[model samples]
Target chain A: MDETDRLIINSLQGNFPICDRPYLEVAQQLGISEDELLSRLQTMLDNRTLTRFGPMYDIQKLGGSFSLCAIRVPAERFEEVTEIVNAFPEVAHNYERDHEFNMWYVLATESPEQITHTNQAIEARTGLKVYNMPKIQEFFVGLHFQA
Target chain B: MDELDRKIITATQAGLPLVKKPYAALAEQLGIDSETVKQRLRNMLDKGQIRRIGAVPNHYKLGYMANAMSVWNVPDDKIKELGNQLGALPFVSHCYERPRFLPEWPYNLFAMLHGKSREEVADKVQQVVKLLGEYCVGYELLYSKQILKKTGLRLKAKD
Candidate 1:
């Protein structure tokens, strides 16, 4: 990652003030023109250097509940199970980890009850147990990778 | 749900200014008042549309030397209680319970613990084990060698 990539990654985490010319303001900080800043961000997204560029809402604070869930999907059913799990809007990220419980995903819902409901639905749909692992405690909240 | 909300998210996600009156600057480009931008952000936060708006430092650069994904085998009945207790720990950054891939894997609860060194992480795991006692049947610790990606969702196009 070059200087621009580093700058973009660093600024992406925090609150961007509500303003008319936010990019221009951001440009001023980078000592670049607003057009250049906007164009570079567009390019970064297009290249997939940035997986996503959006607001990361604190679900817990918003009266919703979310948990990290996983299942030991059979090797044969990996692709099938992944489709079913990823179908839910609540399942934000689904990954195949190198572990016994290979398939892992995140479920964020409006309430604790919803979490259970979603788990049951997933179990029924996939014929696999949805290990509902709600956060016991929060040790670290954010993970920002260096560009 | 509204167009402005969408625009604000798009703008912020794309990148925010690193200057004074950043909100005002955004407002100028978007042709809206800075206060409007601020209010929308506040609303998005309250509504759970966004988790947080803050700087996410690169831990490796900061020298947070050790990080591991720890899994525990706790009874279904007590999983919640244990998870809650573990999540509350200062060193535990990421915690969740997943189904045990029995016969192949037996652990259920998982936590991401970070420290300045491998020994520090091991020490914290010991602390967790002590707190949970017999409830924790067994555990394994997987350290992270690399971080592929750590950005928020776009909430559009992917669907």
Candidate 2:
């Protein structure tokens, strides 16, 4: 990534214009052409430097459910269990942490009740206890990382 | 949201197509006009249904390999104030108040910190600790061992 890439990545994390020609507007602000801005963003997305390029929807507001759940996996069966748990389509992201509750993941479902349904399925599949810890309150969600 | 809103969400959920006239492209695909597409997008943004329309960088790939979810056991009443302070930190990606599961789990405050290395993360934690001071009775850094799977939210029938 060059200086221009850094500028784009740092400046466009959260704010993209809501105008008719949003790209053109951003290009003007960044002192670049619309085509250049578009191509650069395309390359970043293609190369996976930027995971995605678009609007971020609040799934919860759309009548969806999200929760952070964890499981304590035996050392020997860690990888095997991860596969089993992640096989579920509702599992959004799964992570292995350095604690007794070693395996943690976020579950995103269509409805709130689906959380319990999926939780039961995952437990039955892995035979490990699933602890669901949903966020009681979200103080902040906006985060920007300057590249 | 109406049927139009739902269609728009499903259409652009994956991402806006990488094209010169992206909204137009969406309009053509959804059988709507470019103006309608843009207007609905604007409405969604205003309604907070859509947080932002932009790029999401890969922080792990961007050299911030060390990301820790710091859970702090702070006083319940003071949680709001301290959470806001922590949320204001640039490196803190997400800050939330979650329920504590007694004997097994006791932390209620969660803050996600990202850094280039464990040392860098630890240093940032020190700053958070100093701010929390005595209110933070206990805390733990759940350093991620691996990313088993990472994907965006999936709506039942659609992606």
Candidate 3:
């Protein structure tokens, strides 16, 4: 990514204007034409540099529940367990980390009760205990990556 | 949210149309006016339903390859004070207080750190350690080896 691309990523991290000519406003601020700005954004997104560009809805506020869950799947059964876990629609994001709790995933359910139901189902399928660590309190979130 | 709002969300959840008049495009798709689309979005923003509207960069692609979930086991009584302090740190992206499952799991505080290198992330963890000198009983840095799945919130059709 070039300097202009970096600038676009940084500037557009938050507070994208809501107007008829929002792109034009941003393009002017970035000292680039609307076409250039749009083209660059398109390229970055197409190449997977920028994952998304839009409103980040707060699931909790939208009457949904988000919980950070983990599982200590044995090395031999890792893939099998992963398949079972990720099959659930509620499992939004899953990751493999270097820890005893090797598998970590976020469960985004439509309601608070659904979280438990999903977890229980996953455990029943995999026969592995699911560690549900829902946040008691959030101090902060949304970190801007400076490209 | 009303049916119109749901339609707007479902239309734009993947992304806002990458066009000069994105909202107008959305309005056209949803059979609504540009003004109404913008107003509802604005209302959601004000209501804290929408955190912000903008580019969500992929940290790994942006050179923040070394990311760690630094979990801490701190005194429950001093959690609020420590959580706020840790969360305020520039390097700490996400900080929260979570429940501790005793005998097996014992971390209540979670702070996420990201950097270009593992050494850089470890250096920041030292800062966190120093900050929690007395209160920090134990901690673990869970660096993600791979992302198995990362599809952010998908609101199923309410029909």
What local distance difference test score does each model get?
A: 0.70, 0.89, 0.91
lDDT of 1 by residue, B1-159 (tens): 577876676567645564445777778978998888888888877776676665454465545777778888889899878888888787776677665656557887878888878898889989999989999888887654333223334434122
Q: Could you tell me how far off, in angstroms, the CA of residue A56 lies in candidate 2 after the best superposition?
A: 0.7
For model 3, the local distance difference test gives 0.91
Quote the positional error of residue A139 for candidate 3 in Å.
Answer: 1.0
True contacts recovered per prediction:
0.31, 0.82, 0.90
Residue-wise lDDT of candidate 3 within B26-124, one digit each (tens)?
Answer: 998888899999999999999988999999999889889888999999999999999999999877889999999997888999999999999999999
- For model 3 chain A, give the 10-residue run with minimal summed lDDT: A56-65
**CA lDDT, candidate 1, residue A89:** 77
Sorting all predicted structures by lDDT, with the top scorer first, yields 3, 2, 1
lDDT of 2 by residue, B29-62 (tens): 9998999999999988998999888889999778
Better of 1 and 3 by DockQ: 3
Query: In model 3, how large is the Cα lDDT of residue A17?
Result: 96
Worst 10 residues of 3 chain B by lDDT: B150-159
- DockQ winner between 2 and 3, please give it: 3
Q: How many residue pairs of model 2 clash at the backbone?
A: 0
Query: Which CAPRI tier for candidate 1?
Result: incorrect
Please list the residue runs of candidate 3 whose C-alpha ends up more than 4 Å from where it truly belongs after superposition.
Answer: none
